[model samples]
Target: MGLGKQDRTKAREELAHDQERAERLPELLRSVAEAERALDEARERGALVEEVHEQGVRLDTALTEAMRAAYARERVLVGVGGYTDRIRRRKRLARPEIKQATQVAEHLLTVREAHRLHGIQQAPRSVV
Candidate 1:
């Protein structure tokens, strides 16, 4: 069956949105990279725990947004491919970005764990 007018309109809108997102992918990736660098620098400088945590949060948000943009860009690519082929292509396109994000996340987790340990060490011990 042919698509209804409303369906066609919605599809067009979605395509347009995906195209915009594809155009923005580079900027989003740059933001993610910048946030990751800032977080790394904060850790290296031994900044306040709160400051490091804030940086980590920023990195997390940037990474999430960049990932969404990447997925959107992938969706916008039209070609002759089976489902598995498309899935493989998407994974290939995303692998590097995913690796970078994973590294940042792991580093943030380590920093958080260290902070938690430090807090525990600073807490006063009560004698039973």
Candidate 2:
């Protein structure tokens, strides 16, 4: 059967609604794109923080190992004058390595904190 006048009016109304939604498609797409970009940035920041922390841990471990070696060298030199000089030279060499490791670990911690703050700042706010 052919559509009655009421049916025809309902069909026109539905078509208009669909057209309106289609017109809003670009805006919706842009919003989705922005959300995705924000998510990507947050992930990148988190990764950077993790990387920095790992580096700090590695540096700390190296410093610990170097100190252990220096202590062992000192203990072995207890009462010999000639060997005491060798121990001093070994300690002097280890001192720079320890210092460098300490500096690098501190710097990495600072970098991690900065990245964490950046991630928090970039967090997307709800539109509600």
Candidate 3:
């Protein structure tokens, strides 16, 4: 009903997906291992050249998929409000930019001091 509840529901749904992937990861790993073994056996037997190539391709594809699933499982969120690992970009400032910023700041300070002095000069004086 509320935005906060919606956020929590989304987070829980994501966690459930991750958990499902994790549950299937073991089976995927086994499949990859079996494919590798089959490919090796085909190679050892000197089977048809096309068959060997096909087996090798299958093994490679399975291995890649299994690894991806494992990585996704490992990166799953831990808690409801925890932060996810993310890539951050560093802010780089050129020399010219830094110099211009410093000049602007100095100008602002000078203007502020001038305004303060002006205010002091304009204040009503006490009568003797």
Give the poorly placed runs of model 1, Cα more than 4 Å off: 79-128
Global lDDT of model 1: 0.61
State the displacement of the C-alpha of residue 110, model 2, in Å, after optimal TM-score superposition.
42
- Please give, for residues 29-82, the per-residue lDDT of candidate 1 as tens digits: 799679878878887888877777777777667766666666565555532221
Query: By lDDT, is 1 or 2 better?
Result: 1
Task: Report backbone clashes per prediction.
Answer: 0, 0, 0
Candidate with maximal TM-score: 1
Q: What global local distance difference test value does model 2 have?
A: 0.44
Give the alpha carbon lDDT tens digit for every residue of 19-95 in model 3: 67756667877886798688788878877766776776666566555655554454342333322212211121224
Which candidate has the top score in lDDT? 1
Task: Give the TM-score (vs. native) of candidate 3.
Answer: 0.52
Candidate 2 on 1-128: residue-level lDDT in tens? 45467766665564454445435434543553454455455456765544444444443433333333333333322212223245554565456554554444455455445544443333234489
- Please identify which of the two predictions, 1 or 3, would achieve the higher TM-score against the true structure: 1
TM-scores for all candidates: the values are 0.61, 0.35, 0.52
